[model samples]
Target: MAKTKTQTATPAPHTRTRTHRALLAAQLSNSVGDGAFYVTSALYFSRIVGLSAPQIGAGLAVAWGIGSLAGVPLGHLADRRGPRGSAVLLALATSAAVASFLLIRSFVPFLLAAALYATAQSGLAAARQALLAGLVEPGARVGMLARLQATLNAGLAVGAALGGLALSLGTRRAYLAVFALDALGFLVCALLLRGLPPLPGAPAASGDEPRLVVLRDRPYAVLTLLNALLLLRLPLLSLALPLWIVQRTSAPGWTVSALFVLNTGAVMLFQVRAARSVTGLPEATRAVGRSGLVMLASCAVFALTAVGLGPWPTVAVLVLGAVLQVVAEMRHSAGSWQIGFALAPADRIGQYQGFYGTGVPLARTLGPLLVTTLLIGWGVPGWLVLGAVFLVAGLVTGPAVRWAEHVRSRAAAPAAGELVKAN
Candidate 1:
């Protein structure tokens, strides 16, 4: 996306600077391969490697856990070192981890490789976000983030198509090709980073070394936790909705694909427009609150799906719900980018971004279990409760963010005074 926003809200692809365009292109390439490999991984493990579905799940869960733990330290490393170098290194590590799947014949090796992959992926995300914060101005960062998200959706769609085509080939080697494709994309992305200015490694003005500033800021930590739950929207659509449609709702099975198409299409077509209002933290907080209300309505509509009105009625309600959910998704994501950037100290953004990014792996890891228990287990009541959580968390964000900024300012006062005295 272009740095300038007003007249052309959605900049043409050619308008962005070379480094900015390259980063966005790398995002698309990486996500395409991820989309393909993700679809194939479970089947490959079960059919080719002789591992059960649960074993595959266990390995992935463990990997994500490891990834979460590794995030902060790696991010701190990026803050000290250059983010450009760290991002390139971890991207290469991610490629190696994906390629290791080719050697997997048993469970132990698979688990080890997966842990490495997940950890490297988490570190890569932290480093990349730091890179963005350094390269992009604060005023334009959230918009840039939304534009990248749109590219990711587009890339995933392409990847999914390719994966389906490969599935038709139906050979073990064909599945392995999917993995190889994902690895190659990472290498490409790493190479692209070589052209980026070593932006993340901006030299820090002398300030206290951060051991765990993010953790100590209780309000900020709380916001991270709440945002993590709000992100359950992802699992709700990708995993729970399909299961709910099949078992509880009277909606036709194919409706699931329709919902995915609508959500993906909305994100690709309108994510930047949705982000325009969120250029700063106050606006972002409002957007988040608005998203919460949308989510509440969507969940309530979804609850109606189980009433069994008829296939068409169920389809209507489900489609409506999906549309609202996409709105919520767009608003929540844009708002989050602003909040994360606003709350982080400029000098320690790599560490703070790393801390903030943890919410993703943490949410993705717990989201399935949470969705299954709340949405699937209890049915209607579960949906209502989920809606309530969104409502509360969304509204709470503004106050929480204000309080975090207060704490951050208070903490910085002593240092400022000390500098003044030295001068």
Candidate 2:
């Protein structure tokens, strides 16, 4: 599980170019599969798989709750080994897990696959981020991450459309295809990084220390909490959206595909421009706050669909809400990028990412249950609650960003040569 540690002379111009191309290609493939899989799962579970909305909600909660716990161990592995090895192994395992879905059709086995998939996903993502940190020139880090996000968005746009089209073939078959594509993407990623220069990180940092020691960092904790809140809303798109389309809207299933298509398009178009405009941590937080306001506004629109709006109008409202939510997601993604890269200790990037990732899954676990309960009881009220959560997230994130800035300034100001590590 160790990486090749051989270092050559500084990477030549052609070498950097080749590596960048390889990484981009791999990312595009991977994200296409990711987008396809998520949308396909939503359609399959809600429509063909015979799971009720609440059951799907519960499954998502359990799967992500398990994922939250799995992050620590996965992080330790990545830190102990190297990013390349971790990413490759996890990618292969994920492929197997996805393939298993074809064999096992019951709830328990499907749940097991979900947990395994989440674990593998966390590992691959952490390794990939770490690898980027390891491989790119320091000056290029910001652009590199931004470019990666943008590329992911592009893949998402294409994947969603393709997955939607596959749905016409039949749910089980479509999902199988999604998994196959994901498997192929991982294989490509593994091949591209296998022989590249090894990532250099700081010495091993133990994660077994008291949780409080890490938790006491108020800013990081707040950031984590807010992220969790944001992730909680994911079911809106993942579960709620498809359900709404089939049960409520007269729009064809094709419309569901179109919504995702638009979401990814927004992300691809706005991400780089958005990142460029917001240059620092505080700025990014403010942007998230503003997007939260937009999300808050959009929720009312979604709620209206349940209020007897015609199919066309409901479809329009749904699209508007999705667009607003994606904008907020873009803001959150940008801020997360800055927080994760800046706050993580040089030697313990995987652990820090693991920590950050835990919050999102934890939030997702709770959100589905809470929202589902509301959906059962209050209907449109549930949608409103999601909007409220985002509002709170935005408000809380503002102070968290300020606190991080304060800590960073105080630590780095007095010591000129040293790196200021946020725990």
Candidate 3:
């Protein structure tokens, strides 16, 4: 008599627990480095590396574009090989890429290094998501992701302060030190990943299963696009709001930094709580819908700042808007995690997550231009349109998710019947 699946899986509670902690620790370590790198990279390139602003911008844009295309194949590699090893290798590659930046004195070297860094970061993200899916129970993945988000925010805050210190020093040595710190962080991330239990590679694809099944997944692709639209919020605070505050509103210059601090602090404190109630697809969709409404309200509040308010009044309005935006950000993040994980096939989690993760780079690439144009060039009406976009995307998520679920279920039915017949 053979045992059922549960009967054969009773001894790994402790291992799972350790894997969870390891994932959180790894996220914190790398995110801190990313924070410092993001804050100082432009200055380092211009002041120390002798690169023009346009050159640096072009290099990174091209790098992330290449990275977006690389994610699917690399994710497929993770699925065919093993996520742990893939993740470890990619982390090391990322560290190497960052180190290369320190030595790059020309445009070509910077471009190559930046591309490698982007590709490795993209692949590492996909592999880690797959690893998390393998190690954690399906029901708990969202909560775990929320905790990771909180940890990431906390780490980034600390790293940002360190970056600020380096910026104030404004020396060649200080800039080099920040880059070195980023390299070291990724190195540490690689080591932490190496310690995790190795998961088996996914079984070989059958003749019917295409190597890149995710590419053929239309419903999942639709959801991915919709999620990408929502992710336009990525540049809202960083690019749009700052410009809005500086050019349009009467808020003090420091209000921009204050708003950023408010957003990060709010996420660190409340993200897990925001995610706690979102346990399934229905809840996830609802959370997203609610977030859109809140985001719309926040947009309205931000628009009010343009009406010739006093400095304190403008600051107050900005803070209120920032608070609302962060709340929406937290909820949208939680819901998107649940949807991305739930829609993916268990065996193809790596490739699926990799494809899903493209939304980030897509947002990064297109979001600044789109957000700045809408929020700054178009002004109040633009805010309304942006809010409407969020609202529509959130509203449509439920139907899109249902479509994906239906397709996935339909695809699974034949396999289920085949299993039953064999048994």
Name the top lDDT candidate: 3
Runs of candidate 3 exceeding 4 Å displacement:
1-13
Using Cα atoms with residue i matched to residue i, what is each candidate's TM-score against the true structure?
0.93, 0.81, 0.96
lDDT of 2 at 310: 73
lDDT of 3 by residue, 343-414 (tens): 887778889999999999999888888989998999999999998988888888899999998998897798
Cα lDDT tens digits, model 2, 84-147, are 7787787787777767766655677778877887777766777777677667764455566777
Candidate lDDT (C-alpha), each: 0.86, 0.70, 0.88
- Sorted on lDDT, highest at the top, how do the candidates line up? 3, 1, 2
> Which RMSD values do the candidates have, in order?
4.8, 5.2, 2.5
Model 3 residue pairs with clashes: none
Candidate 1 similarity to native, TM-score: 0.93
Q: What is the overall TM-score of model 3 with all chains considered together?
A: 0.96
CA lDDT, candidate 3, residue 128: 91
Tens-digit lDDT string for candidate 1 (1-423): 111111112344454477678889889878999988876788888988999988998899999999988988888778778788999999999999999999999999999999999999999998888887777767778888998999999988888877877788878989999999999999999998867766535454335544656767688788888788789898899899899999998788999889988998999999999999887878989999889999999999999998888999999999999999999999999999899888887766777788888889887888889988999999999999999989898999989988887887897798778878878
